[model samples]
Target: MAQDDKAARGPSVAEGAALVDLLLQMADDDLVLGHRHSEWLGVAPDIEEDVAFSSIAQDEVGHAALYYELASQLGAGDADRLAFDRPVGERRSAAFVELENGDWARTAMRHFLYDAFEEVRLDACTRSGWQPLQRAATKVRREEFYHRLHSRTQLHHLAKAGGEAFARLEHALADLWPYVASLFDLGPHAAELRATGVLPADAAALRSAWEAVVVPELSELGFGVPACGGTDATSAAHRGAHHPALAELLTTMRAVLDVDAAAASW
Candidate 1:
């Protein structure tokens, strides 16, 4: 597509809504995952890594807020309420976001996997037909650039560490690879968004793009790619399946917010 053509046409209202829903899921996944990651704040294995990881976690939360703001403008509800008040099952986020921060290796694996996928996904959005979404995508793509850098740095270092770090990276990848598929499970919007050109690509194409990026990275790290099926794959790592640590993380993350009985400002 030509830049002038894209600039001239932009996105229609309905198309923008479709784009916002996609953005919301992206944002929600990052937000929840970041909150889980923050549990490692003071406990990170090293100070420099802790700082780097913290920035990624913060970026996720910031990205979530931007998506939530868009959703709220579209009448989805206020950002905080949409983020905090929804029941877990109502959340459109993939199960990967809810995984426990098992160890630095596991956390780093999550970062690597999610960031790798998000980069492609956002790039697709950056070229969206809708102006608002396209603009938002441009901004988000910039932020994710850093997220990818931070994650890859950790992934490479840990994989090369050749001790507990290596073991941790291996185990984390083994655990996270299954749920990685869920990131592209675009669901009912797949057709509608594609037809409207709201999404520049379809789920199958997105999945392929993700694999193209992710597989090579994993290979370089000496890890094998994990198999993925739809939600019916029936494994401990299946989509929609939440980790045991998720409940605990939610409890702590929401505790302060829950205390105010719904009317309090965050």
Candidate 2:
């Protein structure tokens, strides 16, 4: 069959599970981080940033909805339920996103790092053999350009300011670096996804692509760029495990829905 025809028909039963796994991973990452970003609404360092982070948070949640919708079509259940109702252990978001947003510097550092990784991941998804994912990724990538710009610009300004600003950012990077590899862990069906071209690149290739973009930029900013691969045992557990923070986050995130279970259906 032609490539387009294959994509239009969707993945075979054998590939369906892997495709759903990939979709949930993408969706959960955005959803969890978006919630974290939203926490800055009234409290960001400045009014301008408050608005910027709010807008960025909206975009990330919207992107998550897009991915969740795709997963729902593939029989993952309602998008809202998939996002809000999943148990902590069932969530596929990386540990990096699940961590509480520490401080302004930590938030900025996480934003820059996650956006850099997202750029790489989404770029690869744009070329995926799955046409639906390719199209959705293309849409998300357009909006992500501004996100990357905002994060990079923030990092540059903070780095150039020196003194405590630079020190804080450096500290944030060190604290966050170990969890970075978890973002590239692609879940259990990674090999199948790569073989079927559902994901155009495997985790290692994606990580390398991410490093090429970030490592030099970070070095130029005078930050010590750490080695790129290898997750700690906790982070290496992929989607099967999560930090304790995620459980707390979910309770708060689902607070309203928990009260009104019917809200999720709407």
Candidate 3:
């Protein structure tokens, strides 16, 4: 198909709503988690990982902006305002992204878990019949290749090291699993998304696929994940709820935008 032809296929109003719903969930996840990862700029285990993580943060934020631009085309809002000006309750990020970045182990574990889910989601999006998403997913999935490797390498080394390092990694896994599993929550437009082929599957199907990949990988790393990830109720809570940490992060993130005059360019 020609690129121009693909770009010309705009969604109907109802389909646009589904598209917007998916876009907001993805944009919020990337935007919020990008900020969380940015918190580790100077605090990762070493300068190498710090720089690597900073790049990952930048990639995530770029992905967020891409998605927000797609939303803006659908009449959501400008990317800058959509990302920075939204009320806390209006964002649809999975609850896990809202968690505070802890020590090295916790941060790496969160990255591994999140990157795993993100890889799967990008794969699904690549299969979306929607042209804009198809292009974005293809591009983002290429970048995620390095992210997946970087995160998995960190988790593997820590888990295999044994002693305090191994113990800390195991503890991080145990502590983060509940929140991390919520990444698959698809928010309120699952049916429309699936029906329109904007998403390849419903939340439960994607959650199962995520577990199929992540569970055995964790088991191989020698930590038994105690819970079965998120239930329907938990998924709803994860998609709908905001953690206290998000508010704090937003306050700092929106500072420049909030204080400046409306027409000021930065």
Model 2, 22-94: lDDT tens digits are 9999999999999999999999999988998999999999999999999999988989889888988789998
What are the lDDT scores of the predictions, listed in order? 0.74, 0.90, 0.84
Writing each residue's lDDT as its tens digit, candidate 1 over 60-145 gives 89888888887777677888878877765556677777767777778888888888788887888877665666788789888888
Scored against the true structure, residue 123 in model 1 reaches a CA lDDT of 80
Q: How many clashes (backbone atoms < 3 Å, residues ≥3 apart in a chain or on different chains) does model 2 have? A: 0
Best by TM-score: 2
Q: After superposition, how far is residue 83 of candidate 1 from its true place, in Å?
A: 0.9
- Sorted by lDDT (best first), the order is 2, 3, 1
lDDT of 3 by residue, 1-266 (tens): 54345347678788888899899999999999999899888877789878988999999999999999999989998989899888888888887888887778888888988898998888899988788899999999999999999988878888899899888888888777767645776867788888877788876777777888888999998887776844645542567677678889889997877776675688
Which wins on TM-score, candidate 1 or candidate 2?
2
C-alpha displacement of 21 in model 3, angstroms?
Answer: 1.2
lDDT of 3: 0.84
